[model samples]
Each structure stands twice: as structure tokens, then as C-alpha cells.
Target chain A: AQSVTQPDIHITVSEGASLELRCNYSYGATPYLFWYVQSPGQGLQLLLKYFSGDTLVQGIKGFEAEFKRSQSSFNLRKPSVHWSDAAEYFCAVRDNYGGSQGNLIFGKGTKLSVKP
Target chain B: EAGVTQFPSHSVIEKGQTVTLRCDPISGHDNLYWYRRVMGKEIKFLLHFVKESKQDESGMPNNRFLAERTGGTYSTLKVQPAELEDSGVYFCASSRIAGGETQYFGPGTRLLVL
Candidate 1:
């Protein structure tokens, strides 16, 4: 079955430190990968997505992700972490089987904590 | 423009009671979806609606859950005789088009059953 895996359950980083959150997916075809973040009381916000073309994808809030097909991974990275960036991050793969309208399969989220 | 919005940000009820969650998608969005996340699990899809029609409900756990999109507008998900296992956060999302569009999500409804 198609699934997304976010290996890290919780990660702590000092403010201004570099950050990386790992994600791996199991899918049969070329997958559409996405990163979403949910702050305390906010909804899930789109960080970045990778469908085709260049492997590096840039998203809002100074976040970027790289799609590595060979490794079946789409890990999110940021050059520097901000206190406001502390949030729960989720990795998801779009199931394109039942058309592009296919439902999204999400991974158990990774919660990030920033320490000043 | 307003993003998706869900009513009753939180709900708490005893087992065997009924609860209904509402979702109002962004104006002009043709597609809406429902997802749920139990305590320690990944958020899973529950269903999808294209306007007023139910396109797919394969992810719905059982018949105890009923979802409807009336007149292609706001939608509601009603759970009758709710069970403890039904306690979770329910999320609603919308997009103008399905295949290649970004889905905007709403603050989820956190449900707790005693």
C-alpha cells in the first residue's frame, strides 16, 4: 500500500540553527510529494510540493525540500530555524490513482521545537 | 479570500451520543475533502466531494459516519452513536481543482468521546 513515513517524531533545534526533517514514501509510480506545517492553533499550511522537473522545490516561510526518487525520500530543509518555525510538520504523498483527485496519504507528523 | 473553515473547533461528548461537524470551503472551490487523525496515527482520508456530489468515500471507516455536501456549498459530517474509537481531529480541505492545485485546509475539529 502507498504510505508516507516521517521518521522523526520530535526534533529540537536552537534558534538560528540549520534544520532538516526527514521523510520517506512508498509508492508505485512517480509520486507527488508535499510538506505541510501546522502551528499551534492553525490549519495545515503548505510548505512545498514536488511533482516533476527540478528536484529542489522552494516553499513559503523559507522552507525547501528535495525530491530524491532513488531514495524514495522528500526531505524538508531550512538554512536557519526561527522560533516561529516551531510547528508540527507532516509529509504527504498524493495518491494519483483514482485520478489526481485521489486523496492524500499523510505520514505521522514530526513535531519541531525551537529553543532560544 | 477566506480559507476553509470548520465549525465547533472542539467537541466533547459521551459515548453513544451524536455529533455533527461542519465545513465551509473557500468560495469557488469545486472540490472538498475530509481527513482524520487519531491520537498517534497519520491523518487519513475520509471522503471527497465535488460540488454537491460524493465522488469518493472509500476512506470512510464505517457506515456510522455520514457526510453530505448540500447544494454544492458547505458540507457536514455527522457521526451517530459516536464511539470512543471515533475520537480524533477532523480536518477539511478545499481546492479550485483537484489534480494540480494546492489544497487549503481549515483548523480541524478536535473531538473527544468519554
Candidate 2:
């Protein structure tokens, strides 16, 4: 019954610009959050993950995300994006169902377009 | 280390035809998962396997789809009597542990059911 929502369908930003992709999730317990990126014809790559720890989590390629429990949001941010950052980004949540097997629920994804 | 690998990067078949997709997980991974994405939908979980046992298959849409992991190393997902609605990209991922673990994905198999 866990679900994730990504408000933006497409985001266009110029190179070197700061970027933020919004993500919200609904789950019963403390959630496991993750961010992934997928380039054309490539598999999904993990950007970052949030379990139980500091609110801010740093990821590869200079990307970061802050988990806000009050708002039920885990938004991805980058100080400066490069042209190669253009790709589809997905926000996912895993429910803590007290089981060893837990599947991830993903949002529809936000397609990032880095403009020159 | 090499990441997960899937066989037959793409497949095109007519409606009612049968298609099978294969996935070879990371060398030491024990947990493997299958997911699919329609043209514009989020990736949906199809099943999960721990070694050779199916831990969770609740996400499987129907009986027409079958997934098996033999010897706990690689997996295969077969869809019989494929429908147009089955056209999508099927992705396979693997993790070292069962729960709360990071999963690495393989390049998906694009299946088109005409």
C-alpha cells in the first residue's frame, strides 16, 4: 500500500544551474527512500538512499537529497548540473513491513533536460 | 565487478506469442528482482527471489507470467500468450541481501507485442 509521487514530469534547466526534483511518499512506517537515474537505453543507476540517519544524504555525481518527515518528501538536489545530467530520475520508497522481502514502489519519474 | 546482465536486449513478437527474458545477477548476489515499465508508467515490481526460492510474487500480474531462478545464480521470466499490453521494458535487479539492501540493475529487455 506504499506509493510515491513525483510532481514534475519534465524539468528543463540550463547547465550549471541548481536543480531540485520533488518526491513525496505515503507509507505506514518509517520508509526507505532512494533516488535513481536512467539514461537512454541504459539501466537504472542508484543515485542515493535514505534509511535511518541524518536527514541529508549525499549521492554520486554530486547529487544530494534531504528527507523531511513532516512533509513526507525526499527531494533530490544538485548545486550545479552538467549536460550529462539529463536523464529520467525516479523516486522510490520501500515499506518496512517487518519482512525480509520488501519491494520498492516507484514514482512515474521526472525527465531532466539540461539545456546548454 | 560486472553488474547484472540481461539477455536479448530486445524482442518483438506477435500477440499470443511466447517470449522469455533472462537475467544474470551479480556474481555473489542472492536476492534477485524483476520489474517492468509500460510506456509511460512507473516501474512496477513483478517478483522477488531469494536464492532459488521465490520470496514474494505478489506483484505478478497473472498466471500467464512465470519466473524461475535455478541454482540461485540466474533467472528467467517467461510470458505466454503475450498481449499487446505486455509490451514494455522488463528490468532485472539484484541485491546482496534480502531486505533493506541496495539493488543493482541490468540493462532491460525491451519486448514489443504486436
Candidate 3:
């Protein structure tokens, strides 16, 4: 079955530190990948997505993700961490069935905590 | 433009009671979706609607859950005789079109069953 795995359940980082959140997916074919972030008491927000072409994709809030097909991973990274960036991050893949962009299969999510 | 909006940000009810959740998608968005996250589990798809039609409901848990979108506008998900396992955060999302469009999600309705 197609699934997304976010290995890190929680991570703590100091302000200004670099941040990386791991995400791996299991799919039969080339899939559309996405990263979403949800802040406290807020809805899920799209960070970035990778459809095709360049392996590296930039998203909002200074976030970027690289799609590594060989490793079956699409890890999100940020050069420097911000206290406001502390939130729950989820990795998702579009459920491609019958050539239609169906629902998304999401990972368990990784919670990031920023310490000042 | 307003993003997706869900009603009753939080609800608490006893087992065997019925609760209804509402979602109003962004204007001009023809596709709406319903998803749920039970406690620590990942968010799971419950159903999909294209306008007023039900496109896919493969993720619906069981018959106790009923979703409807009338006039292709706002949608509602009714859970009758709610069970303890049904307690979770229900999310509503909308997209302009289908094919790989970005889905804008609502704040979600957190339901608790005693």
C-alpha cells in the first residue's frame, strides 16, 4: 500500500540552528509530493510541493525540500530556524489513481520545538 | 478570498449521541474533501466531493458517517450514534480543481466522545 513515513516524532532546536525533517514514502510509481505545516490552533498550511522536474523545490516561509527518487525520500530543510517555525509538519503524497489527483496520504507528522 | 471554514471548532458529546460538522469551502472551488485524525494517528481521508456529487467515499469508516454537499456549496458530515473511536479532529479541505491542485484546509473541528 502507498504510505508516507515521517520518522521523527519530535525534535528540538535552538533558535538560528539549521533544521531538517525527514520524510519517506512508499509508492509504486512516480508520485506528487507535498509538505504541509500546522501551527497551534491553526489549519494546515502548504509549505511546498514537488510535481516534476528539478529535484529541489522552494516553498513558503524559507522552507525547501528535495525529492530523492532513489531514496524514496522528500526531506524538508531550512537554512536557519525561526522560533515561529515551531509547529507540526506533515509529509503527503497525492493519491494517484486512474490518472486522477485523488486524496492525499499523509505521514504521522513531526513536531518541531524551538528553544530561544 | 476566504479559505475553507469549518463550524463548531470543538464539540464534546457522550457516546450514542449524534454530531454534525459543517464545512464551507472557498468560493469557486469545485472540489471538497473530508479527513480525520484520531489522536496520535496520521490524518486519513474520509471522502471526496466534486461539486454536489460524491466522487469517492472509500475512506469512510462505516455506515454511521454520512456526508452531503447540497447545491454544490457548503457541505456537512453527520456522525450518528458516535462511538468512542470516532472521537477525533475532522478536517475539511477544498481545491480549485482536481488534478494535483493545492488543497486549502480549514481550522478543523475537534470532536470528543465520552
Candidate 4:
């Protein structure tokens, strides 16, 4: 079974501070990873995805995530996060057993709070 | 291009009542998925519909949960005799094709059972 674990339940960072949200996934085959963000009272928005090639993937709104095979981790990072970047972050792994399916297993998510 | 849209942004109903959640996928999307987040936990996949056919429904919790996609464009999930445990935010998402693509999500229907 493929599962995702986001260690941080909540993270507080000051404006303009660097941010890193940890995500670890457990899978047997070549894993496809994704990071999504959800604002309060809003639907989730795709931030970035790592299907193949580049380990460091860039996403919208200055967000990026690195996929580390050895660590089994896909960590999301931002050099300098703006206050507007505050939101809930989720990491998902696509199940490939059936071939190109939409069965995404997601993490519990990490709530990010930005302070001034 | 319009994104995936779900009807009834919020619904509050009593236990034993029935609630049907609707999801309208993107204009030409062939795959529609349903997921739910309960008690602030991870968003879990409920089912997936490829056109009017159910592609995968392994994640559905129980028999009380019935999902249907009549016209292959819009889908509905009906919970008969809804329980308190069914209270959560149900999210609907859709992708353009069969591959592992980016799925656009709806605002989600927050179901409160009291």
C-alpha cells in the first residue's frame, strides 16, 4: 500500500522567511509525487508535481519541491515565503498498480501560519 | 476555462437524513474523482468515474455511500441515512485524461451532520 506522511502538523514562519514542509512517501515502484495547497474556504490548488526527470521541481507562487529517492521524501520549499503563502499543504502519491489511475493517496497535511 | 465546480458549498443535515453531493467536472474532462476529509485528517479518495462508468470505487467507506454519474459530465454521491461519521468536506476533482495529470478541484461541500 502506498501512503504519505507529512511530519509537521503545523508550521509558523515569519514573513519573508524560508519555508520547508516535510513529506515522506512509501511506495514500491517508480513514484509520482505532487504538492498541493489549500487556502481557507478554498479548493486545493496544485503547486508542483514530480513525475520523472528533475529531482527539484518548481511550482507556482515561488514554491518548489525536491524528490529524494534514498530518503523517500518529497519536501516542499520556498526561498522566501510571503504572508499570502500561508495555507494548508498536502503531499500525494499516485497509485500506479492499475496503470495511469487517479487513486491518489494523500498525507494528513501541514498547516502553515505566517506571522508578521 | 472553467474549473471543476461542486454544488452546495455547505450542507448541514441531521443523522438518518439523506444528502446528495453533486460535482460538475471541467468542460471536457473524462475523469472525475471524489474525495473527502474527515476530522481534519488527510483527504481520502472516495471513488473515480471515467465518463458514466465507475472506474474505481475501492475507497468508498460503506454500502450507504452510492455514487452515480448519469450523463458522464456531472456526478453525484448520495449517502442514505447519513451518519455523524459522514460529516466532513467532500471534494470533487477532475483531470483532462487517463494519465496522472493535474486534477482541478472544486471548492468542496462541507457536510455537517448534527
Candidate 5:
């Protein structure tokens, strides 16, 4: 079974500080990875995805993630954190079966708190 | 373009009652998906529909849940004899058929079974 683990349940950071959220996955083979953000009272928004290519993938809202095959990790990072960036972040891996798309398996998510 | 939308932002019903949640995907999106998030748990997949066909329902919890995309445009998930453990936020998402891997999500329907 494929599963995702987001170690940080909650993270607090000062505004303008760099941010990094850890994510690890357990899968049989190379899988598609994604990052999503849920703002306060907002719908789930896609941040970025990695199917197969370069390790580093850039996403919307000035976010980026690096996929490390050896460590089975795809960590989300940002150079600076904003007060508005306080939200719930989820890490997920797509169930890829023979090049076809499958449902996404999400981690427990990490709630980010920005101290302004 | 309008994003996916779910009706009745919040619904509270007594246990053993029946409740139906509706989802209207983006116009022309062929892939519609259902997901649920129980309190303090990760959001999990319930099912997926491709043009009125059940593409994948492996994630559906049990027989009490039934999802149908009759016209392939909108979907309804009905839970009969709802249980208190079924309370959660149900989310609906949709994407285009061709090369549309990214699924857009709706605001979600928050259900509470008392």
C-alpha cells in the first residue's frame, strides 16, 4: 500500500523567514507527487506536482518542492514566509498504474502558523 | 470558468438518517472525484467518475455509500443509515479528460451526523 507521512503536525515561523515542510512516502515504485494548500475557508488549491523529470519542481504562490528518489522524500520549501501563508499543507502521491492516473493518497497535513 | 461546487455547505442530521451530497464539476470536466476528511484525519479518496462511469471506487468505505454521476456532469453521494463515524467534510473535484491530471476541488460539504 502507498502511504504518505508528513512529520510536522504544526509549524510556527516568523514572517519573512524561510520555510520548509517535510514529506516522505512509501510506494512500490516511482509515483506522482503533489502539494496542495487549503486556505482559511477556501477550497483545496494545487501547489505543484512531480510526475517524472528533474528533482526540483516549482509551483504556484512562490512555492517549490524537491523530489529525492533515494530518500523517498518531496519536501516543500519557500524562501520567505508571509502572514497570509498560514494554512494547512498536504503532501500526496498519485496512484500511478501503468501510466494511467489513479486517486491521490494524502498525508495527515501540516498546519503552518506565521507570526507577524 | 467556474470551479467545482458542492451544495449545502454544511449538513447536520441524526444518525440512521439519510443524506445526499451533490457536486457540480466544472463545465466540460469529464473526471469527477469524491473525497472525505474525517476530523483530524487526512483527506481520503472515496471514488472517481469518468463520464458517468465509475472509473475507480476502491477507496469507498462501505456499502452504505453510493455515488452516481448520472449525466456525467454532476454527482451525488448518498449515505443511508448514516453513522456518527461518517461525519466529515466531503470534497468534490473535477478535471478535463485529456491531459488534465490536475483536479480542481470545490468548497466541500461539511456533514455532521449526530
Candidate 6:
């Protein structure tokens, strides 16, 4: 089975400060990874996704993540986070079983708090 | 274009009552999925639909939960004789096709069982 772990339960950052959210996954083979953001009372929105491609994938809202196979990590980073960036972020992985359509396995999620 | 939409954003029902949730996928999306997040738990997959057909329903908890997509466009999930354990936020998502496509999610329907 495949699983994802997000170590941080909550993180607080000041506006214009850089931020990093750690994510680790346990999968037998190369896996498809994704990051999503969910504002309070809103549905999740895709921040970015990584399939077979460059190690560094850039996404919307000036966010990026690096896929490190050696560490089994795909950490999300943003140089300067705005106040609007405060939201709950989830790290997910796609699991393929016997050539069947796979579903996303999401981590518990990290709640981000942006301060002024 | 309008994104995925779910009806009855909030519902509160007593135990043993029935509840139904609806999801409307994107206009051309062919794949629809159902997921739920219980209190203090990660979101779990419940089922997936490819058009009007159920592509995968391995994650369904039990027969009490039923999902249908009659015309391959909109989908519905019904829980009969709901239990206290069934209280959670149910989310609906849709994708254009299968395999590696990004799925868009709806705001979700929050179900409260008292």
C-alpha cells in the first residue's frame, strides 16, 4: 500500500516570509505526487503535481516543489508567501494496483497560518 | 468554465435517518470520484465513476452507502439509516480522463449526524 506523511500539523509564517512544507511518501516505485490547498470551508485546489519530468516542478501562485527520489520527499516551497497563502495544504500520492485506475492517498495535511 | 459543484452544502440529520448528496462534474469531465474525511482523519476514497459506470468501488465502506451516476454527468450518493459514525465531510471530484489527469474538487457537503 502507498501512504503519505506530513510531519507538520500547523505552521505560522509572517507575510513576505519564505515557507517550506515537508512531505514524505512510502511507495514501491516512482509515484505521481501532488500538492493541494484548501481554504476554510472551501474545496481543495490543486497547487501542483509531479509525474515523470524534471526534478523541480513549478506551479501556480509562485509555488514549487522538488522531487527527491533518494529521500522520498516532495517538499513545497515558496520564496515569499502572501497573507492569502494561509490555508491547509495536503500532499498526496497516486497508487497503481494491478493496472487498475489508482486513487489519491492524501496525508493528514499541514495547516498554514500567515501573520501580518 | 464552472468547476465541480455539490448540492446541500450542509445537512444535519438524526441517527437512523437517510441523506443524499449530489455532485455535478465539469461539463466534459468523464471521471467522477467520491471521498470523505471523518473527524480527525485523513480524506479517504469511497468510489470512482467513469461516465455512468462505476470504475472502482473498492473503498466503499458498506452496503449502506450507495452511489449512482445515471446519465454519466451528475452523480449522487445516498446513505440509508445513517449512523453516528457516518458524520463527515463528503467531497466530489472530477477529471477529464483517466490516468494522471488532475481532478477538480467541489466545495463538499458537510453531514452532521446527531
lDDT of 3 by residue, A24-86 (tens): 999978889999999999999999999999999999999999999999999999999999999
Which candidate would rank higher by DockQ, 4 or 6? 6
Task: Report the C-alpha lDDT of model 5 over A1-116, residue by residue, as the tens digit.
Answer: 78899999999999999999999999877888999999988889999999888999999999999999999999999999999999999999887654335678899999999998
lDDT, model 6: 0.94
User: Which DockQ value does candidate 6 get?
Assistant: 0.75
Task: Report the lDDT tens digits of candidate 6 across residue range B1-114.
Answer: 999999999999999999999999999999999999998889898999999999999888999999999999999999998999999999999999776899899999999999
Where model 1 places Cα greater than 4 Å from the true spot, the runs are A98-100
Give the alpha carbon lDDT tens digit for every residue of A1-116 in model 4.
78999999999999999999999999986798999999999999999999999999999999999999999999999999899998999999997765437678899999999999
Off by over 4 Å in 4: A98-100
All candidates: DockQ: 0.71, 0.75, 0.74, 0.71, 0.58, 0.75
In Å, residue B55's CA in model 6 sits off its true spot by 1.0
Q: Deviation in angstroms for A26 in model 2?
A: 0.6
Instruction: Name the runs in model 2 displaced over 4 angstroms.
Output: A98-100
Question: After superposition, which runs of candidate 3 have C-alpha atoms over 4 Å from their true positions?
Answer: A98-101
RMSD of 1: 1.0
Interface RMSD of 4: 1.9
Task: Summing lDDT over every window of 10 consecutive residues in candidate 4 chain A, give the lowest-scoring window.
Answer: A95-104
Q: lDDT tens digits, residues B1-114, model 4?
A: 888899899999999999999999999998999999998789999999999999988889999999999989899999998999999999999998765788889999999999
Winning candidate number (lDDT): 3
What does TM-score give for chain A of every model? 0.95, 0.95, 0.96, 0.96, 0.94, 0.96
- Clashing residue pairs found in predicted model 4: none
Q: Which residue window of length 10 is worst by lDDT in model 6 chain B? A: B95-104
